[model samples]
Target: MYQLAPNIELLFTEAGPDAADRVRAAAAAGFDAVEMWGTSDKDVASLAGALQETGVSLTSLLAEPRTNFTLPGTDLGPFFTGLDRAVENAGLLGCPRVVLGSGIGFPGAKRPQNLARLVEVFTEAVERTRGSGVRLVLEPVNTRVDHPGALLDRTADAVLVAREVGSDSFGLLYDLYHSITEGEDPAAELANAAGLVDYVQIADAPGRGEPGSGAIDWAERLSVLRASGYDGPIGLEYFPTTPSVESLAHIKAVARDA
Candidate 1:
């Protein structure tokens, strides 16, 4: 069975704004792991305490300020500063990974040029974060539905950038929801991405809701993921149309046997 880390930002809001309480709630609900977007606004002390008390692992968190390398003349100082902060917080939370994004591309810049810029920026990022014990995973978000005009929308492109960065510390976050929403086949993309994927996340397509709320074949997709050789925890990064626990029933059942 695969371990599932629910995204607390979207999963346990019923526990209210303090993510520390959400960590406790998730632990009570039998989740041993959770993920979130950013830590800038959170009480790190409280969060760390809760995780320690509950023994729940923080699987991943976002790299803040999501630097847009495609934008010309963009100041990178703040981006690097934010990354340092992210690494610090990850250390406090015992998180293993930090998710990075391409941000929206600079208007009228060629896609290749944008991707090349991403390579340059991420190469430096990987080098900077080396030996921190926190792996950096670059995510390719869907531009069509949720993130319009996002620079890295294709899984192949993300894999290429990860390849160019050429470090085990730097790898890809192959989000299945975003991939399907972008009209890519799961089997094919997972095959192409292969061993480079260090993280994975999921939501059903069309509505971005919990699995079974949309058209994806969970068993088939999970099988494809297994075949692709990624044994890491999968982040449940979907919105719920029902109560969070109820929303998980479908994927939980499917994943248990997958």
Candidate 2:
């Protein structure tokens, strides 16, 4: 069975008494590893302390100032600087994965030229972090519901970019919610991009909440993942309609039964 890590971004809405307290809460709730979103407001020292206190592992974090720097016209220099900081922080926090987002689509830019820019940028970023031991996860946000105008909305397209970039340190962050919202069949599409998918995250299709809270069958989906040989942690990335602890309790139970 693939291990699952709780995404602390949803569970702990506040920074609480201190960052270490957050790690305690995660452990109390039965999670061994914790993940975070944008680290803009976080104090690195406190988070580092928390990990030490609770023995909770820091799984992954999204690169800071989460913006679409991948758009054709946006300057990539600043984005690269932020990414470098994220890499440095990952080393301190013991996180193995960093989520990378591509900005929006350029209305007038030629599609192929824009794609080439993405390839070049990702290749350079990988080179800079070659010795850090942190892998970059490129995610395709769904343009249909949440982010409209995102350039890398298709999993297959992102896989193509990964191949073009030719970096073993970079790979796709296959998110099931966005793929379903955009009308892509997860099993079939994942099959096509089989070897290229490095990490997989999931949420129910319509609500972007916990699986089994909506129409998607967590059991069947997980079966597909296991059959396909993806033994990575199943990331719980979603917004909670109620308090995160309660919502996640349901998710844990469902995942257990599945």
lDDT of each: 0.90, 0.79
RMSD of 1: 1.2
Candidate 2 local lDDT, 31-141, one digit each (tens): 887777766677888888889878888877888657746544577777888898898888888889899887774456676776777888889989989999999988887
Please identify model 2 stretches exceeding 4 Å from their true place.
14-19, 71-73
153-249: candidate 1 lDDT, tens digit per residue: 8989998888888898998898999999999998899888877899899999879999999999999999999988889999999999999889989
Q: Which residue runs does candidate 1 get wrong by more than 4 Å? A: 67-72, 106-108
TM-score to native of every candidate shown: 0.97, 0.92
| Candidate 2 lDDT for residue 172 | 82
